[model samples]
Target chain A: MIEVEGVERRYDGVAVLSEVTLSLPKGGLTAIIGPNGAGKSTLLSVMGRLQKPDAGRVTLEGMHLAQAPGRAVAKKLAMLRQDNHTAARLTVRDLVAFGRYPHCRGNPGPEDQAQIDRALAILGLEPLADRFLDQLSGGQRQRAHIAMVLAQDTGCILLDEPLNNLDISHAVRIITLVREAAQALGKTVVVVLHDINMAAAHCDRIVVMKGGRILRHGTPAELMQADFLSAVYETPISVHELAGRLVAVY
Target chain B: MSPEIRARQITHRMALLALLALLAAAAFLLLNARGSWDFLLPFRGRKLAALAVVAVAIALSTVVFQTVTQNRILTPAIMGFDALYVLIQTGLVFGLGAGRVSALDARLVFGLELGAMVVFALLLFRWMFGPAARNLHLLMLVGIVLGTLFRSIAGFLQRIIDPDSFTVLQDRLFASFNAVDPGLLTLSALIVAGLALILWRLVPELDVLALGREAAVGLGVPQERLVLGLLVIVTLLVALSTALVGPVTFLGLLVANLAYLLLPTGRHAVLLPAAALIALITLIGGQALLERVLHYDTALAVVVEFAGGLVFILLVIRGVAR
Candidate 1:
């Protein structure tokens, strides 16, 4: 489990995240749905240990992220930020192989290679494995980044805005990959998503935030009411049952 | 390409560069040694070694620096090494007059320059990288500001100095292989080799670091500490090379970019040496060509700077910095 308590982060004395307390269970896909500047990414970043909080502490799988050794924490959890840019021309396989750096330290054994191969296979990245990242389309590059995290093979994975430039098909493929990783591999996956329908349709739980505070955290069925979402977004939203799943429209 | 094939290709390219560097070194030695074999051999050999050291230092520093900053256009040159030298030289001449400054022992002048550069690099970078870890663009801006400030101060000093003294000072300013201080050269080799020892361990981390700060940190590379270490190493190497020889300005830029273009990969293990070899080839080969065929009296720095400046502008025009 990942637990965050009283986490507060400020930029230039302005609170970007405030008094945020949340927990992610051991397994399953948890989508963080929120408006822009809702502090959802900030909360996730703190939980993943990407950005340190001004107050409070975060622990992953009972180990405090701040105090844990970097290698140890890396073995347990993986975090991917929104903007991953590089001028280095790296092949897909080369990029994915870096996931094992914490474990192998650049000298990969048979098992590390196996993990890399599995990551590539899981993401359907085999065909494009030899291609350079810059040569690939944005959706492909997004998947390649996702493949790298999956190759880390950690217990908990945090991804912010993984669907930024992905098309519907690739996005669905990625969600399915995340869901499968959570269900089959028993990994705790926390994804910050902007789309409510995708979160409702796929995630086991959705955490809603507004103005740097967590407003709601529940299963899709529990938070599927129109009034609840409308209140959270400060706009009129309607919820309807589509294909036995709650879909939100505004 | 797959890792194995790409790895093989990189090896082949490195071997090619190494062979070319060797050939150039041999040609430079043999062609330059026409009369008084004993006297010329050691003399030319020392000069050759000095050139090789400067080339390697500049090339590796440039590549490592570009990777850290994630900006291809930025180099250690931009960090004010040459400008700092000019400012110091001009200041010394302005205050003490040309005769007094020129009368100072060559060893004393070299020591002063080296000490000033080391202090300058340490002070400037210690504050530049903040706890929050400022972005690459901000760092570039700071370097440019410092360089411009140094240039302006040097300009002010040069304007007031007499013409005869100014000409003498200009000779000291331009990079000339004929005038390398043996004492400084030995000191530089030791310092650069020490930096290289530390960098050997950092090669793997640097490969990952080239992916940028967020990924490096996320993957457990300890971005802050690694970047600080790299900055220090780059600073020392740049200072050492600049003190040993007058600044080669774009030589590092030219060699590093060529290495990248020749071998397109993220592996620094291959990239560093490849860049070093390219630097060697450019320096030794160009030096030999100018000395033998063209019988050029101009400093090698002139040709290097001209070529490097052109490459810099091409990179900018191509928008490769992004």
Candidate 2:
């Protein structure tokens, strides 16, 4: 399980994540849905060890993340952040191969290559494997980054807005892959999602954050009430039941 | 595509280029001399060694700096290292009399200057690049302000110093093809070789760092410690090169970009050597042209800067940088 307790992160004396505490059991897809500035991304960043909390502690399976070795945290939890920029011109394959860094350090063996190939195949990036990242379209680039994270093959994956710049087709493909990562591979997937309906439809659990605080956390059916979501979002959100799944409409 | 195959191709091309650049630098050094071969050989040989030292220092530091900062257009000069160097030289002359400055042991003074530079950089940056430091732009801004301040102080000191002292200071302030110290060359080579060995172990991490800070951290590269180590090395390198031959502001920018354009792979293993070779080629070739063609009408630095400035403008306009 991944746990965050009293995690507070501040920037310039303003708290971005204010004493937030949450826990995620192993082998589940938990989508954190929040409006802008709700601290969802900040929370994920803290848990992933991309940034440390000003106060509070985060742990994975009873191991203190901050105290653990860098490679240890990396192996247990992988994070793919939004701003994926590269100074060097790297091909898709090279980028994915880097995902295996924590596993092989720098020296790669056949196992690392196999993992990279699996990630590429799962993302339908085999054809674009040779292309430079700059040569790819926006959607293709998004998929390439996602492939890199998946190639990491960690027990828990934390992605912040992984669907950015992707079209509906690619978006749906990625959502499906994320679901498989949880169900088939039994990896804990905590994704900061923007689209509430997608979160309700696909995720096993939903966390609603507002004003740097968790407003609600429950199963989709439990938290998908129209009035609760509307207050959490401050925009009128209508919730409906469709095909035995809760659909959030805004 | 098989990245291994692509890397192999780039390595092969870089190897060929490296061979050509070495031969060209050698030929430029060994070619015609009007005086005795024995005297001329050593004379040109010292200059060659000086150029090699400066070349390796600038090329290696710029590449590593760019990797850590993830900014291709930025060189060590931008960090105010050379400006600090000028400040140290000016202050030395201003404090100790010009007669004393010239009388001091050159090697000892060079070592002191290098030490002061490295320490200044460490003190300036260590507190700023702390764990909470998120913005690299902050570092650049501080660098710009510090560089200007150092230059201003140096300028003020120069104006007050005696003319003879100013003349003595000028030798330290400007890069001179005719003025590399033979005593320092052997020491500089050993340092560069030592740094090369240390940097070799860092090659893989260097490539990962080019992916930006968060990515590097996520890859378990110990980003902060690694960056600090690299910054110290970069400072030492800039300090050595600037103190050894004065500063060549644009040579690093030119060589690094040329390496990026010429080498196919992003691996630092290939990029660093390729850039160093390219630097050697440019320095040696430009010196050869300055001597044989222009007849020393102007400083080689001026000509190289003019070309490098053009390349810089072209690169910015093309918007190919990160």
Candidate 3:
């Protein structure tokens, strides 16, 4: 479980997240949905200990994030940010292999290699594994990055805007992969998504944020209400049940 | 092209290039070797050793500096290390006349210069790493300002100094591989070797770090501590080279970029040695040409600066400045 209490983040004297307190349960897919400047990425970064909160604390599985050794936290949690610019020329396989760094510290044994292979297979990246990341398509590169994060084998995985450069098909495929990883492997998955319909269709829980504050949090069936989303997004959003699944129409 | 085939080609080319560099360096050493076998061997041997040491220092420092800064065109020189070194040399002569400066122990002067460089680096990094003004351009601006300050101070001191003293200082400032100090060569070699060993141990981390700060941190690298340590290493390397044969700013830039182009792999393990070899070849080969073909008419620095500046401009045109 990841717990954030009284978390606040300010940039240039303007508050991005103010007194935001939330507890994310273990072993499920939680999609954070928000409009622009909603602090969704900031919250995820704080939870992953990538950014420090100004006035609060975060605890991951009874270990305080601020106090825990970075290696220890990294072994239990992995984060993938939106922008992944690397100066080094790394192949997909090499990038995925770096996920085992916290575990093997660059000296990978057979088990680590096996995990890397499994991640590649899961992402359907076996063919592209040896290809350089820059040589691959944007969607393929996104999948490779996801594979790397998955190869970390952390119980808690946080992805910020993982679908940014992905097409609809690749986006759905990634959403499915996240859902399956959470359900089958019993891992906690928190992803910041921009598409409301995808969040409604795939997420177990929906977290709605507007202007850096959580407006509503509930199962998709409850949080996908027209009025709730409309208020949160500051636009007209109609939620309808189609094919036994809640879909949002803007 | 298939990645496997590409990798093989790159590796093969890198190997060929490295071998060629070694041969070139060897030929330079042999051609320059003169006088009796005993006297010529050790005398040229010392110069050869100094050239190799300074080459490795400049190459390693430039590569690592580019890695941390995430900019291929930027070298340790941009951080004002070479300027600071000049300032120190000038200050030494200005404060304590040429006689006293020459009387000072060589090792002590080298230590003082190195210490000042490290402290300057630490302070610059600490300021840049702060939350406010986290921009790379801001750091670059600060570095440029600091370099200008050092240069102005040295110039002011030069203006007030005696003409004879100025001549001595000018000789010190001019980078000449032919006149390397044999007395300080042994100590510099040991220091450079020790630094290389420590850097070799950090090869894996350095590889990860080349992925940029956020990515490396997300991958669980101790970013702050590792960055500080790497900066110190960079400072030491730059200082050693600068103290040994004054500042050869563009040589490092040229060698490191050439290494990257030749190796075709971002892996530091290959990149480091490739840069070192390129440096060795350039220094030795350039010196040999200056002595043999050019008939020692012009300084090696002029050729290096010209070639390196052209490469730097080309890199910028290619949009690798970022």
Candidate 4:
């Protein structure tokens, strides 16, 4: 379980997140839904230990996030940000192999190779593994990066806007993959998403944020109401049930 | 490519580097052996040793600096290291008379230059801007400002010094491989070797570091401390080489980029040696051509700078600045 207590983050006297407390239970998909400037990415970064909170504590399975050794924490949690610009001429396989660095420290053994192959297979990247990142299309590159994080084999995965730059087909595939990983592997997945309908359809729990604070948190059925989303987003949203799944139309 | 195929390619490149380094060393030794066996051997041997030391210092420093900055076009000299050395020389000549400055201990001068360069680098790194400002443009901008300041100060001091003393300082400022000081060379070799050992121990970390700061940190590398250590190493290497042979700014840029083009892998193990070999070939070959073809009448730095400058322009035009 990941627990955040009174987490506060401010930048140059402007509060990005204020007194945000939340708990993410293990073995499920939790979608953090919010409008722009809602501190979704900031909260994800704080929970992943990428950024420190000004006034709060984060604990991951009984260990303080800040105090734990970086390698130790990396072994248990993996994060993929929105933008990954690199200067090195690395192929898809090369980038994914780096995911095992926390375990093998660049000297990958047979076991590491096996895990890498499994990740490539899962992401449908075996054929494109030899292609350089710059040569791939945006959706392919996004899937490649996701494969890298999945190769890390961490129990808790945090992804900030994983659906960006992906086409509809790739986006649906990725959402299904994340859901499958959470259900089959018993992993806790936290993702920040802009598409409210996708979040409602795939996420077990949705947390709504506005103006740097969590305004509401509940199951999809409760949070997907038209009135709740319209108030949260400041736009008219119609909720409809299509084949037992909630769809939000704005 | 398959892993086996890539490994084979790396091994092949390593073999080629070893062969080139050996050939360069052999040619250097043969060219320096001209007079009586006893007298000429030791005398020219010292000069050869000095050349080898400078080559290694410049090559290693350039490769490491590029890695840390994640830039192919940047070198230690870009940070005004050579300008600082020239400024120090001018200050010495301007403060004391020529006789006193000449009489000062060579080792003492080397130590002072090394210390000043390291301190300057630490200060610059400590004041680094935010992540968005960490691009090559910012580095180049700050470097140009500092370099202009150093050059202007040195020029102003040079104008005030006596003509004879100014001549002495001027001779010291231009890069020439033929007139190396043996004492300074020995000290520099020791410093270079020590730093080389430290870098070898940190090779694994450096491989990760080449991926840039955020990715390195995400992979569990202590980014701040490692970058600081690398800056210090780069400072020592740059200071030692600049003190020995003035400054050859574009030489590092040429060799490092050439290594990148020739070597297919991103692994530092291959990239470092490939760069070192290119430097060795350029220095030894250029020195031979100057001695034999040009009758040892001109500075080797001029030819190297000419070739390196061309390569620099070509690389920029080719849009490989990344």
Q: What CAPRI grade goes to candidate 1?
A: medium
Pairs of colliding residues, candidate 3 = none
TM-score of chain A, model number 1: 0.97
Lowest lDDT 10-mer window, candidate 4 chain B?
A: B127-136
Kindly report the docking quality category of candidate 3: medium
Interface RMSD in Å per candidate, to 1 decimal?
A: 1.5, 1.8, 1.9, 1.7
lDDT of 1 by residue, B1-322 (tens): 5768877888898899899999989988889557899888898899898999898899989999999988786888887888998888888888888899888987888778878987887776776775654666666677789989999989988988899889888887877778777887887888888888788788889988999877887788887788888988898888778777777887888888888877878888888989999899889988887787668866687766665567657865665664
- DockQ of candidate 3 compared with the true complex: 0.65
Cα lDDT of model 4 by residue, B230-308, tens digit? 8888888888888787787777878888788767667777787688778877777677667656777788887677766
Q: Quote the lDDT for B121 in model 3.
A: 86
- Cα lDDT, model 1, residue B60: 87
Task: Give the residue spans of candidate 4 off by over 4 A.
Answer: B1-3, B129-140, B179-183, B309-322
Q: What share of the reference contacts is kept in model 2?
A: 0.69
Tens-digit lDDT track of model 1 for A1-250: 8898899999878998889899878999999988889998888888877788999999887899977777788888888788887789899999999999889877789999999999899878999999999899888888889989988889999999898899988899889888998999899999999999999888999999988888889998898899988988889999998788788888
Q: What does candidate 3 score on TM?
A: 0.94
Query: How do these models rank on TM-score, best leading?
Result: 2, 1, 3, 4
Across residues A1-250, which tens digit of lDDT does each residue of candidate 3 receive? 9998999999988999988888889899999989999999999999888888999999999999878887788899999988887777788988999899889888899999999999999889999887878888888888888998999999999999899888888788889989998999899999999988888888899888878788778898888789878888789989888999888899
* lDDT of candidate 3 at residue B246, scale 0 to 100: 84
In Å, residue A247's CA in model 1 sits off its true spot by 2.0
